[model samples]
Target: MKLLSRAFATAVAAGAAAALVSLTGTVGATAAGSGTAAAPALTQVADEAPGYAVEDFAYPDADRILAEQGIVLKRGDGHITLAACGSETGLLEVWARSKDKVCFRVSGNGGYLSLEIPSVYGVKGNAYATEVTMTVEDEEKSFDIAKNTWTPVGESADPNGRDHMLVEIRATR
Candidate 1:
């Protein structure tokens, strides 16, 4: 697949979208699903292959991505990551087809905070509704993924939110 930038969002593909996949940088946007004569449309972060991958990202910029403070990628999950980064969340969303959602937050002194995945969890190792570990007031707490872990953030103050949030690959196996 042909990796690209936001310019691809407006590029009128020349030939059949049979070779490379272009990127619009606009998730859920119109160009997120375009193809090129070079390769088929990007179906996911990586096609059905297995290999080592790495991606680095920074705060969003109008031009090419500048200096990045964070990086994310899949060390397992079966797919080899070519393009390794996107957006400011600093979480490398690894998937295709499905619109994935990832939430990141850190805690300094918490009441009730949330921990979410950037992609679908709980279905293998990458399910979006994965579990969250809460340590409040030096006390360990657990929230069921069914009710709370799915919510990116909470409204009420019954629990506290995250502080030094850093959303990256959960593990690098």
Candidate 2:
């Protein structure tokens, strides 16, 4: 009888230990499953730096050109770019200057540009059909520039020789 009682006690102890383990696990699972105030908050980081934005259309070498050439370049569609003067091939040369003429090389089928150059009364086009827009005081004029040749514009086209600013240029293949 003593042996049977000891065996029963051992079985009971084993069952009780198993129950305790199961209960502890159940409590942990229940706490996790509640899903209220159990998850930690996430901190988000910005993809880009603060106070920084990219300007895709801003002119290339703007600071240097503005400082050296005394001309202001604003924005464009990226098909045209400023080039050194006297480029032989594949260039749209603008021969307007207060002291010396400047030029730009244009590529691609067609493109547009916005710039600020005072006293640009004429331009020499390349292989592409070109057009230019100018503003004199409050009057705006659009000129259909000749291809591969110099065409008179602004004050050159105007009998009064009124000064004009070249504002835009468009070229097509």
Candidate 3:
């Protein structure tokens, strides 16, 4: 049994040495400008590797939306998205003096959106509890919107009756 073990070890070592010699010959030939195909350089392989994906959370088609709807949508976590008013039921709706009603669809457990709509007076909330932030002059105010109902916001809710710009919306299930 001892002799058999020694023979097996020797055979394995011999096979490993043969493989090393074969690899070295191939690499040396390639380095010496032989016609055989060569392995890619480290830098080439690295450069060909796929790049890492990054999520900026910027709203898609934002520029087009601003141009067409006069709404400036900045960024969000993708749980909230712009939708056509009356396109579907249960959408969060905003009434702005500067434009016709704008709507947003909310999904997931919660959502957040940063946007700009001037003279926003009211919001129709969906099933989620919702809130909105508005700015009048340099003073910023927040309003909690009643779920599944219309709530006065921004200028309509302000005591001074100052026109306010809707800046943010948050919703939670």
Q: How many backbone clashes does candidate 3 have?
A: 0
- Report the C-alpha lDDT of model 1 over 89-166, residue by residue, as the tens digit: 323232211223333321222122222222222211222233343343444433333322223322121244432221
Each prediction's Cα lDDT score? 0.30, 0.81, 0.90
What TM value does model 1 have? Answer: 0.21
Give lDDT for model 3: 0.90
- lDDT by residue for model 2 (1-173), tens: 99999999999999976775576654223444542333557877887779968778988888898999887888998887888876557677665657357787788788888998888877888888888999998999999988888899888898899988998999999
Residue 83 deviation, candidate 2, in Å? 0.4
Candidate ordering by TM-score (highest first): 3, 2, 1
Q: What is the lDDT of residue 156 in candidate 2?
A: 89
The per-prediction CA RMSD against the true structure, in angstroms, equals: 24.8, 12.2, 7.9
TM-score of each: 0.21, 0.67, 0.74
TM-score of 3: 0.74
Candidate 3 residue runs with Cα over 4 Å from true position: 1-43, 48-50
* Candidate 2, superposed: residue stretches over 4 Å from native: 1-56, 97-99
Our model 1 lands, by Cα RMSD against the true structure, at: 24.8
lDDT of 1: 0.30
Off by over 4 Å in 1: 1-67, 70-129, 147-173
